[model samples]
Target: MTDSSKWFESLRVSYEQGELNESDITHNPFEQFNLWLQDAINNDVPEPNAMVLSTVNKQGQPSARNVLLKSADENGFIFFSNKTSDKATDLKHNPHCSLLFSWLPQHRQVIVKGKAEEISMQDSNSYFQTRPYGSRISAWVSDQSKVIKNREELEVKVKEFMDKYPENVPMPSHWGGYLVKPESIEFWQGRPSRLHDRIRFTKKANNWTIERISP
Candidate 1:
């Protein structure tokens, strides 16, 4: 085997940050998520709200990308992007998706499986208005997930949009937000000797059922 392969196989971490007990976790998965999120923030974890979003296309091909979490509430987790992008196209065919938040500094991770739904235009615009002017313009300029001749072409498009909307750049109709209504959420805490703790909550109707699964 190659040296890199050997190094990869040898790399290991003995997780001893903390232990997760059933009694310590909140019955409500959302509540537990908030508690852990706050803990991550307190621990100075970088980009605590960042998550890996996984989606599947029509052909059953899966794709995963990192996105920043904009908001989280009883309703669901919210994120925004171009509705015409590749991820958005995947969501159109398959609304089902998974979100993973890895707080490695604390040796904890959260996984959420859910259905994606578009948020209201008002909500999208509200968030859009808060973004920097350049970002707002770029959102309209770049046709996300499309091929371009070169960087010059993209920069030219940006300049055109910037010139067109010198002030008060409007949110494009194709750019919006999506909310993931979680059907199942899991909390994982790492332990020594690879004996991790995993607690999952599954939603049914309006209630949730909690269970502990093997590590």
Candidate 2:
């Protein structure tokens, strides 16, 4: 095989897009996050709401995957998935999790440390009804994260679910949303000479404390 180490070392980019200063950021982490998210959207970054969710299982083994951020506010962030999925299982065992938003095109990233809890079924159903018909059907068909024979098996089940719910598809009991209440949020901005800017906001008793950390 080709020398992959050389290929990896040969790739490099100088980050000079912007600089983040404490004076430039909002006092509230949630507002700051929204500002960066809006910047990503304005820059035409694909899937701007996509975030990496990291969770640790009961065994302390960590796992991470990208999931779309369905909503965010002062309450925290929200995302949905199959209740029986591996990530869900991880959350069930360990509520503490982390979320990462990487906007590489803009040379910025946001990290959130939080505790995730299941949202009310009523809220989940409301969002579920808004999904496309095919998506709703797929939710019922796939046992997400479960082993199956092959693509044919999944496709067969898909067809069956489609036939069963040709009209209004009801949300599956196994599928729902989780709300993550953040305890801390950090924003990182890439800079020249690898001297990145790091700003972190820690939540205290009904207030937030901001600090600038060394790169």
Best by lDDT: 2
> Stretches of candidate 1 above 4 Å error?
none
Per-residue lDDT over 1-215 for candidate 2, one digit per residue giving the tens place of the 0 to 100 score: 99999998888888999999988899988889999999999999999999999999999999999999999999999999999999999999999999999999989999999999999999999999999988999999989999999999989998998888889899999999999999999999999999999999999998999999999
TM-score of 1: 0.96
Per-residue C-alpha lDDT of model 1 across residues 1-215, encoded as one tens digit per residue: 57897797788888999988999988989889999999999999999999999999999999999989999889999999999999999999999999999999999999999999999999999999999999999899889999989999989998999899999998999999999999999999999998999999999888999999899
TM-score to true structure, per model: 0.96, 0.97
Q: Which ten residues in a row have the lowest lDDT in candidate 2?
A: 22-31
Q: TM-score of predicted model 2?
A: 0.97
Instruction: Please give the distance, in angstroms, between residue 124's alpha carbon in candidate 2 and its true position after superposition.
Output: 0.6
> Which residues of candidate 2, in runs, are more than 4 Å off?
none
Q: lDDT for each of the candidates?
A: 0.95, 0.95
Clashing pairs in 1: none
RMSD of each: 1.4, 1.0
